[model samples]
Target: MTDATSRDGTRSGSTAQPVGGAKGPDELRRQIEQTRGELGDTVEELAGKADVKGRAKARAADLKDRAGAMTVHLRGSAGHTVRGGAGRADPPSRRARHAVRAGLGHPRAVLVAGAAAGVAVAASLARRHRHGPC
Candidate 1:
């Protein structure tokens, strides 16, 4: 079987080089600007063809219908959640408070509380020093 190397001693799968050097940053920026200008013109042409008043009315009706549907869905979901949550022995408010207390009991929470206390103490000391030991 023949090896994969080409007749020119380069790898057969390698790409051929471009005729010119790579484009510089300024040329690249110009190309990007040209493309953006063309795209902007295309968008403006498309926007001009649309019927503004009719489109606005249709969009407003669509949004209103969607909002009404969403309100009904959320109301049903909230009712279900409240009913399900209420069936538990612990009341929702008490349960939430207990959860918050438990979270605050963690080491990270204690560390954050300690840091805040330290800042407050330092600020108070600085104020006392500034006011000549009030």
Candidate 2:
């Protein structure tokens, strides 16, 4: 069966077959099922993309893991430095260099940490300003 054409020349309904010839009913049904499955997958992908909270939580978890790993590495390095045969502590600049090296692999975590530190500093300044001289 052929599809009915609307006033604007567009074909409508399931009976419309591709250019070659009319498709068997079974073939049409199979095509429809496949198309539906593909559409469902696309919809699911779009839904996942739309889930902002889920994405944010995943990102936070990832950053947290990276930060934890960096902390452990820094702690191990610090312990090694402190235990060095010289029997003296490393300078602050050396500790900072260790931190920067640890942070080099995870730029996002470093950025988030820096932003958090900035926010903390701003909050501290705001509190001091609010109380007027202290």
The candidate maximizing TM-score is: 2
Clashing pairs in 1: none
Cα error, residue 6 of model 1, in Å, equals 42
Put down candidate 2 lDDT per residue, 39-119, tens digits, no spaces: 999999999999999999999999999999999999999888878847777689999999899899888999999999999
Residue 5 of model 2 has an lDDT of 70
Tell me the tens digit of each residue's lDDT in model 1 across 7-75.
555443444323332388887677679879999999988886676987788889999999999999999
Off by over 4 Å in 1: 1-49, 86-134
TM-score of each: 0.33, 0.49
Q: In candidate 1, how many Å is residue 40 off? A: 28
The local lDDT score (0 to 100) that residue 56 gets in candidate 2 is: 99
